[model samples]
Target chain A: MTPSAEDAAAGLQYSRVLDAPPELVFDCFTQPGHLTHFWAPKGASAPTTEILVDLRPGGRFETLIVNDATGATYATRSVFLEVHAPDILAWHEEHTGMTVRVTFTALPGGRTLFSLHQSDIPDQVLRPENRAGFATTLDKLSNYLHHLADGAKQ
Target chain B: MESMLKNRPPGSLDAAFAALADPTRRAILTILADGDATVSDLAAPFAMSLPAVSKHLKVLEASGLISRTRNAQFRPCHLERAALDGVGDWIEDHRRVWDERLDKLDQHLAELQGGKEERDDS
Candidate 1:
């Protein structure tokens, strides 16, 4: 029952330029071997994992990640809404009722500018005290973007 | 600040989401955002009956989105912006999660590409 307005207000976005070409970057997502190596967050590793990808509109994709420390397992189930090879990927994650879209822009010199957008965030994140922490995160992101831009200039 | 929310009763988040889901309820929150108003003032804006508006207000109040107070005969409802702001924070948390994951992903991609190059050279 997350308010639709909140979803609109809270959509997340980030973009970065990666060293690899678009096709290689795209393959990193579609291929299970590459995905399993990098899909987990910073602290966790995907071990004893199962990944199934159908790679078409309305096709299903799922990943099961196990926490190394606690042995707790988390599963992410999503259905593809759109898939354009080496360019765009969009899916609806069933667990959080969120839609994620990622775009790969091919650049000169085998580099790719990758952009990500996610919307319809779930409700649990709204705990009252987390408000300040949220502001700090945005600051961090702003700094990251500025740093990236500065590096691009240099 | 952590203890501030910890002190609040549980399920406030669920109630807030449920209450805000309705368009009428959201509009009511918007109207109240201007300033506190009596039940009748809020009911006048909508085509629905006063009772219906009251029902929406009741839900909002239960969700901690608004607080009602009585002064003799006037029961004015005040907007609780704090509750809605919590949602904005939650969204920030969502963005951070992806940021952290992508950082890891950046490293992984570097390793994958590096390994491929080494294999090709050999």
Candidate 2:
């Protein structure tokens, strides 16, 4: 076991193993051309524009993602917190109030496994209907927890 | 209720983040998650005054993370789970986007490696 784990506190995580080595994967993340090619959402036809990457502590990364349907552009601006080449890249986005930490692990077959963890995501991304569903689910969970507490007391 | 929605902070997510930044406020939310509570009930657990808890409640209300009932007597504060849940959903959206982008990265890398192998053989 390579001790692959995502911090529960982060609240968001995704891990995938790539066929390339860690170094190569790191370059793909850092390079503007590579990011322009892959950073857009699946099925998104608009090429990513206004890419900026300053790979250092306190450095900034800015990108624009255009929605095909509405032709709306969304901007993501973040300051790098940690940048360990070929191993980790972490950043905190002020506008979104979220911190994203990505870790690159080296596998035996020259493959790389990286996990992306995001903490404190902002509410702007959620649609109203989805938010309503979450509220109902939360109420259910609250009731369940309350019952558990009562059982413990008994 | 519609007025309350209108009164919600302009940048809803920004307000939500600011409201949840404090540990005390987060604890308040956890308690309310159990069930709605009055200001005094929320205050009793903390070593703080009713006014402090009330202030925190106001912040939560403004963030649309909690709602207070109109009843003047209890004015029970209920958890607005949607705001918190919305944060989770936001993260999930980004995770999905990353998954797609990373998959593309994998394919790009395979192409690069294949090119290198062909060059070496030739």
Candidate 3:
């Protein structure tokens, strides 16, 4: 479904200091080759899936995460509305979707401050604790990305 | 958010998640989980008054994390462990989902590394 990625949803911040430079860290996020390393964790078999990305303003992006074992897929596709190099990349994930704004600012000693701030969703309904789940999921992503940067050096 | 999770054990998932989300609620649950407690017993740890404790209890009760029972004029609050099974179940599912993603990443990285080494050798 085409969900609108709006900024109005309560925002979330997930930050980590990647061992790589800002450009390198940014590349992994924007490039498919690098994305497959840190986007989602390992073990999900989505062999019947495709990922596409055009890292530019007004670019189209699409990806399908399918689990063949379970015959499930969470397909999300959107357009890249803006890109500010290694500093920022903004895109509309899918209405009722998530708009992710990832920022990479250089840190001292060649490290990069990686932050993925996503916003746009109404109150936490049903199971209200999803608010905390968001934080944990982001934390996992931060660690996953951190290890990716570390592994690159070894 | 986790609210999307359906087909979970009764009030179990919601109780655990909602309880941990707030410090006051978490402390309250922890107190009850250790043993059944009266309203005054629940109120002792907090700086807040009985009414505040009542409000927190209302939230917990609505979530089915705790049950308030009558004993003479005093109502004792008791923990419902069955209502918290969702916590463990939800967490495990979440773990499995992420673990799957991580596995794919490992394979992708190895392939990238292999390709790079071949290029370097050439």
Candidate 4:
């Protein structure tokens, strides 16, 4: 189930289907090493230089993004609001007074429904650029996982 | 711990994130994000005095969100988006993994239940 509407008004809600198990998807997120690979998709403008996430309510969620050619970091921080294993994660974003909630659901047919809903955000994150950026990242994840799944077959 | 982006480069992620955790400090960053700002310019909006704004500036400085200048002691604050890249990148990573595992679980459940339904038909 999702949070109340009052809660969502503060953020953006997003969900996507993945052809994998919840456990695997959860592992992909919880495992820092794995995260570095697919954080940003190929041909995307931004690059993920670092990702450090502690698996706890008060634990840190830190990462770094850099320009690919210049290697200049664009942003970084460790924000923590709440975390429920394999289900939800809530955190504040870059002093924007907004919060991010990432939800995961296990659907039938070996598919996982993952959604990211950010609340309390304004036009900044709502801009088309931000959404497109995230969509690109998701596309990378799908492609990478598809490759991994294929490898398992071989 | 409270200092404007003086003498320090917006060099690392940890320091940057620590500085951004506060609303006041984040406000300072937002202002800096717009452009450069003097102590007075940054403090103009808040009800607080210049000293209060300076205090926030100190923290921002430590976090690499802003930097001071040598001229006239008017340390201007600047917004540095470089340090914030990690947040979005990390979230994207988590989303990817969550997708993978959730899909796997669904398939497993369907497999178990699918066999039961098939046997029931027989």
Task: Please compute DockQ, using alpha carbons, for every candidate against the native two-chain complex.
Answer: 0.15, 0.17, 0.11, 0.02
Q: Show model 3 residue runs off by greater than 4 Å.
A: A1-17, A44-49, A54-61, A66-107, A112-154, B1-19, B62-64, B67-73, B80-83, B95-122
Point out the higher-scoring one by DockQ: 3 or 4.
3
RMSD of 1: 11.2
**Tens-digit lDDT track for model 1 on A1-154?**
2334333222455677777889988888887888877787755666424888899999998888777788788899999988999999988899887678789999986778888756555555555555554333334433433332332221
Q: How do all models score by TM-score?
A: 0.57, 0.56, 0.51, 0.41
- Order of models, best TM-score first: 1, 2, 3, 4
| Tens-place lDDT digits, model 4, residues B1-122 | 11121222333333343344445665565566567889899888888799888877876676554667867577566654443333334434544644554444444444544544322210
Docking quality class, candidate 4: incorrect
In terms of docking quality, how is candidate 3 classified?
Answer: incorrect
Q: Mind giving the per-residue lDDT tens digits that candidate 3 earns over A1-154?
A: 0111111111333455554567766676677666655555343432223768888887877766655466576666877866887888878777335556667899986666766544332223334454344322334423433332332221
Clashing pairs in 1: none
Residue-level lDDT of model 2, residues B1-122, one tens digit each, is 11111222433654564455455777788898789999999999998998888988987887787888896788999886666666556644565788778767766786778854422310
Q: Could you give the DockQ of candidate 3? A: 0.11
Better of 1 and 4 by lDDT: 1
lDDT of each: 0.67, 0.67, 0.54, 0.52
Greater-TM-score candidate between 1 and 4: 1
Per-residue CA lDDT of model 3 for B1-122, tens digit only, reads 22232222334433334333444765687677568888888888797899988987876786677887755567788876544433333344444554454445444544644543322210
lDDT score at residue A64, model 3, on the 0-100 scale: 64
